[model samples]
Structures are given as C-alpha cells and as structure tokens.
Target: MIETIFRTVDVPAEHRFEAMRENMTNVHAPAHLSSAHAIDFSAEMRLVRLGRLCVWPATVQPARMWRTPRLIRQSDPEQYHLTLMLRGTKRCMLTGRQFGPHEMHMTDTSQPYEVEVVDDHGEIKMIGVEFPKALLPLPADQVNRVVNRRLPGQQGIGVLLTSFLTGLTRHTGCYRPSDGPRLETVLTDLFSAVLAHHLDAETALSPETPQRTLMLRIRSHIRQRLHDQELTPATVAAAHHISTSYLHRLFRNHAHDSDHEGTTVAAWIRHQRLEAARRDLADPAQHAIPVHHIGLRWGFSHHAAFTRAFRSVYGMPPRDYRHATCRPAGPAH
Candidate 1:
C-alpha cells in the first residue's frame, strides 16, 4: 500500500509542448506529441498510489495528439489504463472509438496507439487508473477484447467502477494509511468484474450476471463494428455464437428489439455512427478533413445518404455544421 504517497504535477500555459511531453512520460506513459497549438496548452495531474494500482485525475487544455512510437525507444511496460472521462471527449484512432463524458475507456500501453483530445471546449478532465498487467484477472487476450471500447459509466460494473475511481480522488484526504491495501483490493476486484463482464468470461460470476454481461457485450460489438457495411443482426448474432433469433431475444430481454418497443439494434448502430460523424465534423482539428470524408470515416457509404441522415437528426447539413463550429484556421502556435 502506498497511501503515504500523493503527488501532483502541473504545466503552466507558458511551458509549451516539451513540458507536457516530460510530464506525461514521467507520470504516465511515454508518447510522442503533436499540435502546434501546444503553446496554448496547460495540464495538471494528481496521483495517489495504492499498492499496485495508481489512481490519478488529470485536466488538460487545447486539443493534442499523442503517439507512443514517437519517443519510445525501449521496452514498453505492460500497463493498462482505465480512464473515466469526467469532462470532454477522447478518440482512440486505433479502434475508431470515441469516449464521451461519463464513459470509461481502457487503453493498453504496450501497444502503439493514437489518441486525440476531442473537446472543442477549452479543456478536458478525466480520472485514470493505472495498474500492472497482471492485476487485471483476465488474460492479455481478454483485456484486448475490451481495450479501446467505450464502457458505459451509467450501469452495471461500470457504474461502480466509475464511482469508485472518482471517489478515491475526492476523499483522498480522509483515508488512513492502513487503508491502502484494502483500497487496492477493492480497485482490483471492481475493475476485474468490469472486464470479465464485458468479455463474457463471467463463468464464475452469478448466473444473472452473465445475462447483463451478454447484453453489454452485444452492445459493444455493435458499436465496434458500426463502420462495417455488412454489420447486421445475423452477423452480430453469429459473432456471439448465438442464433439470430436468440440474439433478438437477448435484445428483447434487454429491451432493444421488436415487441419490447425500444431502440432496435440497427437503430442504435445508426445513432452511434451519426454521433461519431458529428463529433469529427465538429472537431477543430478535422477542419481540413472534408465533410464527406468525415461521413465516410464513420461508415456512411454515399454522400447524399450521409447528408440526408445528418440533416435529419441535427436539422443542419454537415458542411454548415462544420462551418458554424470550427474556428478559422490560422498559423499554428
């Protein structure tokens, strides 16, 4: 237990990119940095070491891009980061997943990844838990299954995990030194449950747990493959090793299909696609990426179809929306 140790680091606005690079590599993982607007950046991180797990809350300004291969020259530690997006958004290019407020994202440091801050608002805040590779009960392959995917903070183990991580920072001053090991155990158990639930490896979990885990895994699968033109009910069902009819039953039991009268699986996928596209189109960093390209990036096949769908939901064309949201491009700071 490392309850006796608490540290905080900050990068002032005038410090520029090198300061950020130094801070991140020393405090978190080593990564390459980009963004001429880095001169506009500032950051702060508060860390609490809890045995094998470290809980930290970070707040950063101005959008930034990070790539691990940029500065890493030696062996990469097998560390996994479970991040809760407290405010703003993050898009992991490696998986094409975008995490919004109240969502949790798992990232493995061993793999080279590209992540960019997605909030147009000045800064982003998040609670991140960094733990050793073995601390996660599941095998490496199992962790890979959930990495880069958005885990909802609203329900199931996600809710508990999110609350616990955030509460650690909030009540750090109250915990006694003896609580470190206990806190470490709680962190491992909760996060392990979150991972097991998502991977459907809940064989040792309660019977009822598997059903909820299955539903969540189904939703994750749908979101992950949203860009695939061939993504369909049958494919999702097949991928899960369940019959197409049983898949409908699962969704029906979870209130996602016909007779249950909620958003159908297809509708949910469409909503996610549009939401992803909207984010990209609104991103200041994507100003030069073209409206149609943004649509295509999120799985829209036809320009006309993308435009119709974009206008249908937001009442504004993609072009107009980008024009309205993005600032004029200028010399990089």
Candidate 2:
C-alpha cells in the first residue's frame, strides 16, 4: 500500500506569472513569485507521505521567489523544508551562497527568506522533505544554524539519508500502508541523527537527548566489536571516552523503571554476541563451520555457555535454530 500522491501545474503563457505564483505557494509555503519570463512556466510536485512527513519532490523552471513579511502576515505553514539539489543550482539570500548537486539546505517557511533558481532554461529538480515545525523536537537555536546553511550529504549519516531518500523517491510504490509508522519513525530519527551530528547536540540537547545519543553511539560501537572477547563495559566505556559507571547508567536510563531491574550493560554485550553467533550459524556460507567454532567467533568462551544463551533467547540452541531456518541445498546451481 505504498501511496503516491502528486500535484502538477503548467502555467499557461497567458497567466504564467499568476499561476506560477499559486503553484509555488502550494509547493511549499506561500510566496511571491517574480520572473521576467514567467510564460510557459512548468512545475510538478510529487509527494509521498508516511504519516505526517510529506516527501515533496519538486521540478520546475527558473524563477525568483520570496517569503516576504506581507506573505507571512497573510499565511504560513511554519514548516521546515529541507531541500537537496538533484540537478541545477540555486542562490539563496538567507545563506548568501550557491547550492549545486547533492548539497542540502534548510529553509524555515516561518521566516522571511528569498531564493532564485539559476537555470537559464528554467528546468530544475530537487527533493524537499517538509517537517511540521511544531514536531521537529530539536533545539530551535541549533536548527537555525543548519537551516539556512549548506550541509554535507556525502558522508556519514548524510550519505545514508541521501541514499535512503533517493531510493525512497524511486520506489515509492513498494512501501506498504502498514509501513507508515515505521517509515515515519525512520525519517524522523534519521533527520534527528543528521542534525544532531551537525549541531554536536550530544552536549547541547536536553538530558534525555544526550542519553539517547550516547546509547546510539554505544550500540554502533558494540556492533563493530561483537566478536571481541574483551568487549566488557570498561572496554566499551573507555573506547567512547566515558566511565564504566556512566556506561552502565546509559543502558539503565534506557531500560527498566528501577535501574537495577533491567539487564546490565555487560549482559547486553553478551546477548548481542550470542545474536551474532546465531546469525552466523544460520548463514549458508558458514554451514560447514562447527557450531562451537561459530560461538567462539562471536566471543563465546565455551560451547555450553553459547548453547544456554542461544536457547534462552530463541527457545532453542544455535544448531537447532539454524536447522529450522536453513533450507536444504537444491540441485547444484
């Protein structure tokens, strides 16, 4: 049930200026449109919504647009529209810079800002993800810094987000209706992760923000070392430049009502190691490998310990789970 919702308009030569103006308004926030040749203007807006997020993919010709004070006085969506240039160029007065392909910028529709597309023939394409301003859940000051400025989308989470969005737009029909909540959560979290990385927000966000941020970082670190026999709380904390006590506190804050009731940080490492072991056990390429060898690869100290841990989590030992999941080999090739 991937829903594809789109809007398009081709402003006639007779009413190009006026019609283009209206089209631009609906594409984002209301704005004033001015162009020497607005005639034969063309624009198309493709939107895919997973819950409240509107993935507005836009393509249009050259024009000068502004979110003026007067326009804000009349109407405003108070949304943050993050734009990534797919092709062509743009000059923004707010940031006083030019954005070329693959670079991103954020525009707060609630504020007064102006931009001009640089394409002489008036053809440009880009993706704009509109986030409800009230729902961003980020520090206003930090958001402002990244809003008008160009942010890199070629590295780290930016790369992941850019690839996700590129694929998302290309495969909008593949998403199921039931995927709304999960997709919405992914978009929000990815957005938060990107902006937080830019803002160095681990220290700037609220108490809970740092805790959540730390856990995410810690988890990534743990995943990379699931096979390390010495991946204890102390080692994990030292690698992250935090104390062992503080590391335990992170998982605690993220867990049960009583800090003592939830699984300790050390236990989480063990569980993750066992989970990795089970995955290796199920992998067809590793079928010839011994089960105990797989356990040792994932840091299990003994055959019995790995078996017990695997059974506790999956209601069966590693070998049994693999037997149940792995299909028999068919005729060669």
Task: Write one digit per residue (lDDT tens) for candidate 1, span 119-223.
Answer: 677678988788788765568887788888889998877876786677678868756666776677667766777888788886644454456556656766776
lDDT of each: 0.74, 0.74
Best by lDDT: 2
- Stretches of candidate 2 exceeding 4 Å from the true structure: 1-20, 203-333
Quote each prediction's TM-score: 0.57, 0.60
User: How many pairs collide in each candidate, listed in order?
Assistant: 0, 2
Name the lDDT value of residue 279 in candidate 1.
77
Error of 2 at 107 (Å): 0.8
